[model samples]
Target: MSTTGHHAAHKVVVIGGGYAGTLAANRLRTRPDIGVTLVNPRPEFVDRIRLHQFAAGTGQATADYGTLLGDGVRLVVDSAERIDTAARTVRLASGRALGYDYVVYAVGSTCAIPASVPGAAEFAVPIAELEPARRLRARLRELPPDAPITVVGGGLTGVETAAELAGQGRGVTLVCGHTLAPSLSAPGRRSLATWLSRHGVVVLEAAAVNEVRPDAVVFADGVVRASALTIWAAGFGVPRLAAASGLRTDALGRLLTDETLTSVDDDHVVAAGDAAAPSGRPLRMSCYAAGPLGARAADTVLSRIAGTAPAVIDLAFTGSCVSLGRRAGLRQFARKDDTATNVYFDGRMGAMYKELTCKVALWKIRREARRPGSMIWIKGGPRPGQPVADGARDDHGARDARC
Candidate 1:
């Protein structure tokens, strides 16, 4: 909440404290000339990828920000309400206003709850955020073992949640609107389905849920099943704060930026993570992508101040590491364009790989906080104005999951 000196003093404000926001602030605070202030609602850093484990009653979803943020950066525990680009001021929920020379709009997404599906919002338990996931875990513990728990959606989040709940000896059923993991290779999908069946999880493909009732879920075909506890892992949607602020954003409410991750309307602003629609093609909202995007956003600001050319945002997905549960998982290896290759690792080895990835995500942030500019994210050295071939953007993971 402190900004000293005059107008010439460089200052940057990063809204949101998710992986992208955290990394951007940590990286930018390293520069002695610029001051960085991070705005977030929570005091802790929530590991969004492991939120399923939190809902399953097996893992912790938060880390201490003291260990992940740089010493020079100021942490503001407040939510952003609006951005006045003309004034270079950010309005906070606490009725305070802060001016910035540059701003990073990283206010991450929220649960994508379907409105067409009646009762889904009232009956289904959503675990996308920390507080809701904690409540879901608490609610699951209150139910008996024989209580039928319905998990809607077939994406990575739904699959991981179903496995974790089933491993805890709960009666679980997965209702995928379509085939499971459409983003994965056919072999990869087979492996996941087989493992789910082995654990006694009922997999219902193409069984779209039309409604969620108090004690049961009604399918599109009018069939009803007992669902004492319903967990919704459908999809995620970004908040409309950006659009409400009059910034250029897509239909999904993600801020529109170019290949540089810089705002098309204002050079004083940059964006990253799930909240950014770069060239109208946003990357998959994962911590993996967030890490590099955050790095690129910070680098953009530094290069602006230094009067040097900033690098373009060029990234490729190598593979996807998914955790089925605490015991088993799948690692679907892919090419630069994110098409699933024949290579993969499964079973305990796969689980171990996913675990290491989550750990590495945190480790990278801490390392960057201690040794700023130490992060070594892979970059495609595409010449300026050249269209870099980004990874395959097609995803069939979660069409039903959202806030």
Candidate 2:
């Protein structure tokens, strides 16, 4: 809609202003002829990577869109209700219809608390999203200093939350459904275990919660433990927008796309971030993947406009980092394919690395906003012609439960 002497030949509407959507919108600014509009439910950008810190009252987790998005991108503070791909229109929850030549589907994942677990939906507080983290913070404020806190799930979120609360002097217990920090190497897990033990955190590996009560959790093995507060960090689920919109999606509702990040059903609709399952093989859901995928999604759209063949997605992962608390952390390195490596960093060095990673994530988005096409990622992934193997998705679901 900018009339600054350049009329837009095409318009792009990016849904979900998370790391992916924001980057896609910013990257689209490289084409002045393409008007870009970003749709998000909230006005500010939520730094989801730090939601645990927000819940634990250790740090903040939001930034102004003014600082994160490019000037060429318009911000629409409304949720996308549906996408009519055939019509190339996005219907907003506010009842407005946004016509776009192309659309970027990046409506990230959410906390998944199964109702199958008795009372979990009612008693357990999930800290995956901003609102949930806010609720957890308020609830923590209401509890006494010696309140017994129970963190369920052995993933990164669970481990981090338990460590954070324990650092605050609360009696904490981490109930890992299986191995603790399952995504990390054995030594990394042992290091975390030692730290948790030294801080009086009772880590229950292989303990799955069968039920959550008002004051305790019942394990699958028939053990009942008192819990003043139960924090759920089990895993994440994507929005049902794609499936409801009639687009082809994977079992979990993530939009199915080709290696170029374009939806198989409609080339005009592309996907990125956690909501994207490319070639039926989704990379681990993490901010590390989100930004690069966002860049690729935008490039794909740009390529179509230019009548050029967009290159296949070439992305790699270096590792994953988890903050133990304000001053401690564990950084586990990974292969290009995203599997755990034996190399790990712990203690203050790890904490510093974790903080740097978070800062760098935001910095990358901002840098792209200032200079489109300036971003680059680790390459050397599977060749485009290769068939995706069975269970090809590199899953570190527990480590990136928030993604």
- Which candidate leads in lDDT? 2
- TM-score against truth, every candidate: 0.93, 0.95
Q: After superposition, how far is residue 349 of candidate 2 from its true place, in Å?
A: 0.5
Cα distance off (Å), candidate 1, residue 305: 1.4
Cα lDDT listed for each candidate? 0.81, 0.85
Clash totals for all candidate models: 10, 0
Residue 140 lDDT (model 2): 98
lDDT of candidate 2 over 86-160, digit per residue (tens): 788999989999999999999999888998999999999998899989999999999999989999878788888
**Model 2, poorest ten-residue lDDT window?**
387-396
Off by over 4 Å in 2: 1-7, 383-403
RMSD (CA, angstroms), candidate 1:
3.1
lDDT per residue for candidate 1 within 1-403, as digits (tens), equals 2343234369899999988899988888667777888989999998888888888878988999988988777888998899999899999999998899999888887887789989989989887788889889898888988899999878778888899888888889998777786667789889999999999999998788989998999998989999998998876788887887888998778999987889888888999888987887676677777888899999999988888988878776677877877989898877655567878889999898889888999999898898888777755433234333332222222221110
Clashing pairs in 1: 111-402, 111-403, 112-402, 112-403, 113-402, 113-403, 234-401, 235-401, 235-402, 337-392
Compared to the true structure, candidate 1 yields what TM-score?
Answer: 0.93
